[model samples]
Structure formats: C-alpha cells, structure tokens
Target: MSLLLSPFDMAGTPLTNRVVMAPMTRARALDDIPDDHTVLYYRQRASAGLIISEGIPISREGCGYLFNPGLYSDEQALAWRRVTDEVHAKCGRIFAQLWHVGRMSHVSIQPGQAAPVSSVAVVAERSNAYAWVEPGKAGPVQASTPRALSIDEIQRISGDFVSAARRAMDAGFDGIELHGANGYLFEQFINGALNTRDDRYGGSIANRQRFLLDTLDALAATIGAEKVAVRISPFGRLFDMQPYGDEAETWISLAAALSARNLAYVHLSDQLTIGAEAIPQGFASQFRKAFRGTLMAAGGFNRTTAETALAEGELDLIAFGRPFIANPDLVERMRHDWPLAEGDRATFYGVNGAVTRGYTDYPAYQADASL
Candidate 1:
C-alpha cells in the first residue's frame, strides 16, 4: 500500500490507513446532540485512518461557542452514539477532542451564571481574528477577556474532565483527545504570561506543566493512556494568550511530561501553518524524539510536505483540517495523487447547514472523474 493508504498501529489500536481527519468545529449538533446531518458528516469521511471530532466541552462552563456539544450530559452522549455508530458502520475509527475554552468564552456561553475561568484574567488581543459569530453565522472577529480560575476551582474542573472522558466512551468513541493546546485553559497554565500564580501550580516551567501532568495522570488512570492523546500548539498564538518565556523551554518540558505518561501520541499543530513560523521545527522534533508512542503532525499538511515530515521521522501520522473539510475522501485522494477541492470559506461556521451543506457535499476523485 502507498504511505497514505498503509495501515499502522496507533498506540496499539490498528488503524486502516495513515491519513487522519483533524478536528474541525462545525457547531452543527442540535441541542448539544449530534443530529442526522452530523451523522452524515462523519460517515462520509470514513476513509481516513482516524477522525478527531470537533471539541466537546467537558462541562457547560467549558464551552465557548453556541451549539457546541458537551460530553457531560447523557443526551449529548446518546446523540454522539448515533453519529459514532454510522462512522463505525462505514469502518471508521473516531476520537473526541475534549474541550474547555476557559477564558476564551463569554458570560452568555458560561455555565452556572458566572465568568469564564482561566489561569489569569488576561483577555485576547487580536488584530486579525476570524470565526463564526451569529445565528448559524460564521466568520472572524476579536477575542474577549476571561476571569482567572482559582487553584481550588481548577481541581473541580479536573473532575469535569474525567466525567467528559467517560462520556466519550459512552458515545462509543474509540479514544479521547485532550484539547491542551491553542491558549485554552491547559495552555494558559503552561504558558508563563497567562500563569502568574506563585503557588504550587506556578513559578517555573516544571511547575506550570504540573497541572497537565496531574490531569493526564488522573485521566490516564480512568481510561488508560493507550486511548488518550493530547494536542499542543506550543508556539500557537490564539485565544488572546500572552507570549512570555523562551518558546523552546516551555514546549520541551511540556512534551517530556506527556511522554513520561506514555500517551497514545502528541499532536503538534502550529508547526504545519502556511506562512507563520511560530512553533519551531527543532522544538517539535524534540518532542517527537522524547515521545515513544506515536507522533502526529497537523496544520496545513498536503501531500509533498506531509510526506517529507513523515520521511524525516518527525511524525507517525498526518492530520488534515481544511482539506478534510473540502475533501471528505482525503486519504483516497492523497493515495491516488488527486487534486483537492477548496472549501467554501464563507460557510465554515453557521446554522441552517450552509457551511455544512457544502462541507461533506464534495465528490471524491473516482466519483467526480466518472461525471
């Protein structure tokens, strides 16, 4: 089989191929349960070796976007079950990326009628922010500031995480991907500028990484590390997170901690960006070497560049986001070296399925060629 078509062991779970579907938030789930449209979406993209579902908040407070699903409720799990069943029927393997936007959320989106929590009170400052922002509408905009979470408060959030992971299993998801990247709560704690606590959870890089280590251990104990993966955009600049400290040191320490637990794999996203050179190649490579499990590199991956990363041993698998959005049969296309259709950027986020309508509607190479 070709590299794109080859099957391999992803942390002991045998996958059918190497191409991975990066998680792209469609926000189409109805009432936090995946609807029929959602079911069709995953089933259509079953050709990939693996699929990381859009971020599902562990608790209501963890959510940042409207209509984004939550793993904390039984209804949500049941809704996901239908979607997962369809994907499995098509011979697809899927994982849910557990999420908690922390400070990135607004009070309207927060749970328990309170402010959004984070490592600090700093809000995002974006000169160029993009995302969906209306009734089924999607686009880009600036970020908002969030409240700081106390140490005691963080412990409660940990319990929420465990509950969410269980919900993922209940939804019949094959595994769970902890959203520890992109200036979310976990990243806020890891990054110095966002973390100012002088107590146990702060002080140094090791101290900052402590929260993640403890959380991962607790989570691994619940579902086992083989079924758990953590994604980190070490050099990522999103969610209004402040940049401080030597970029190299923070990520090296962060990777070592995840590796120590022997996770399924570590996904380094920012390294694959188109023009920006935020996450350093050497930094990501260090984690690839430190981590003995599996290494998946995502963000802006196409055929040539993806293959080059794989050939260099920098990654064991490659995940595509926008490509998957436009090319549901991405693995097949890459296998045969077929050209990919560009996604309709205007519909990336919104209701009435405008974005999702064109989302999985693109025809595969073989199907389109016949036409």
Candidate 2:
C-alpha cells in the first residue's frame, strides 16, 4: 500500500516522499531570463520530492505565450542553470516540461508573420492562443489559423525538442518531462477534431499518436528513458474536447507504445476538474494495470481521494497543482490535515513582484488560524 506522502521508488531514483510539486506557469520569466526573484520563488518550495517547471518553450516558433521561460537560447540556458543549482543545493529533484504551442498560438507570436500551425485547421471555443498576457488583461487578441506544417518543418521542430532536452540536462536538472497533453502542439496531433490530415502524422489512432510516439522515441534515444517522463491528459474535454473521437483506443495504443520504452514515469491528468464530477471508479486503475511503469495523477486531488487512488493501485504518485501553488509546504500541511490557503483568483497569473507576493507567499498553518 503506497501512501500519497510516503517515500517511493521511481525509475530507480528514491525520493524523500511521493508528494510532487505540480508545475503551473506563473508567467514570471520576463524577457526569458529568470532573475534573483525566480531563484527565491523555486527555493521557497524546494522541499517536494519532485518539482516540474512550467512548460518551457523549446524553440522561438514554439513560444506560445510571452514571459514564458525558454531553453533554446544561451541566455535562457544560463538562467535555468541557476534555478537547477538552487533546487539541487536543497536536495530536491526537478524536471523541465518542454513545450510547443503550435496552432494554439498567434501569428504575431510565431516566426515570419506565419499563423500558428496544426495538423488540421479546426478552431476551438474561447481560447488562450496569443503570446503571454500582460500584467492585467483578460481576452487575448484573436489568433489566425496556423499554416499546416510540412514534413521538413516537423522534422525541424522535432530536433528543437531534442536540443531542449539536452539543454535541460545541461542545466543541472534531474530530468525532463514532455508536455504532450493539455491541447498543446503534441496533443493537437493526438486529437482528431484538430487533425484531419491523411499523412503519416494524422488519421488512425496510431497515426494521430505518431508525433508523440516519434517524439518519445527521439527523446528516449537522446536522453535515456530513465531521465525522461511524459504528461498526458486522458480524461476531460480539455483543449476543446478533441480526444480524436476514439479516445480510449488512442490511449490504449498510446500507453502501450510508451510502456515499450520503460521511461521514468507516466503522469496522467485524470484528477477531478472544478466543475466536473469525480472520475468513474476504476478507469485510472485499469490504465495503471495497463501501463507497465511508474504512474501518477494530477488535477484537484485531496488527501483522501489521492490515497484511495493510490491504495487501489491506480497511481504510484500524485501531482497537486493549485494547492502547491498556494502552499509551498503542502506536503507538511497535508500530513497534519492543515487547512489550505484560499488562492486569490485575481492573482493566480500575471505579473508577480519580488516577494513572490502571490507566488511563494502563502502562509503556513498558524496556531490560531482556525478562528
């Protein structure tokens, strides 16, 4: 029986515990450089067994939002080196989530005045497709339909991801996790509604999942599978509810292919959403049985729910997003059943100043907190 807050073995790396500091993009990396403030923000929460940074763009064309940290440039690499060094000094392991926004980006943000690219041209409901938002703004400027990527372009982007992985390793980080979910570039290729092509990269389940699979192959070859992980959202109408119609088959085949690699871990995005009900009882459990490697879950999981999932053999680790964002010492809080800090919706994203005022300023449990 694995506990949500106990030490566990993942990819042969032992951790202080199973509690992981889930990644949330705070848009804090202004000018693509992590300042002294960035160093303190991460060090404030360096106690998690594992910490994954917000999605870091892998190429210039891959920059989906402004202020989003990147790894493709020399300066960005230098900044990340500082972050990794701090986390390591505290004995904490961290992984960088390499990202590419693809069609989910604005023409103004991409290269050569080019529109955002995708496997198909299908658009989604209200989207967040522009470059990074300024300090205080709601709707982003409308993004144009991206030009479909050619095979040569795809190859180029693949190489970009490979290089980014190398940079992550060079930055003194423990590992890297491919952001293959949440309707991002790799995911756009996985979902059918957005991918209506007849090429080797689109159509059938295997074809739709081709880009991710190939990327995994390249990543495993470039960085040992033991140093690589992948994040996937199996449940949820996320990113415009485009799960390729036959999502189950897609996941089945996708998980099976990844299992073949025996990577570091496979973190599933199946936890409950704000308005969505609990997941059907045994679905994730079944998927865990299906996968032959380390498994984790994220998205709104409380201690009991997480324990149940882990107890049922559905997950080996759990990733808590919003909670960890508000409470840097979440593991300590959870252990003592301490109440959580109610995160301010207003300050969840956007310009955060030096104090990490909204970033790492969440107060720990106080003796008189319970009025």
lDDT at residue 56 of model 1 (Cα atoms): 87
The global C-alpha lDDT for each of the candidates, from Candidate 1 onward, is: 0.78, 0.78
lDDT of 2 by residue, 211-232 (tens): 8878878988988989899998
Q: What is the lDDT of residue 326 in candidate 1?
A: 81
Count of steric clashes across candidates, in order: 9, 4
Flag regions of model 2 displaced more than 4 Å.
130-139, 271-281, 352-355, 366-371
Worst ten in a row by lDDT for model 1: 127-136
lDDT of 1 by residue, 118-173 (tens): 78777766522223355455444444567877788888888888888998988899
Off by over 4 Å in 1: 127-144, 271-277, 352-356, 366-371
Error of 2 at 336 (Å): 2.8
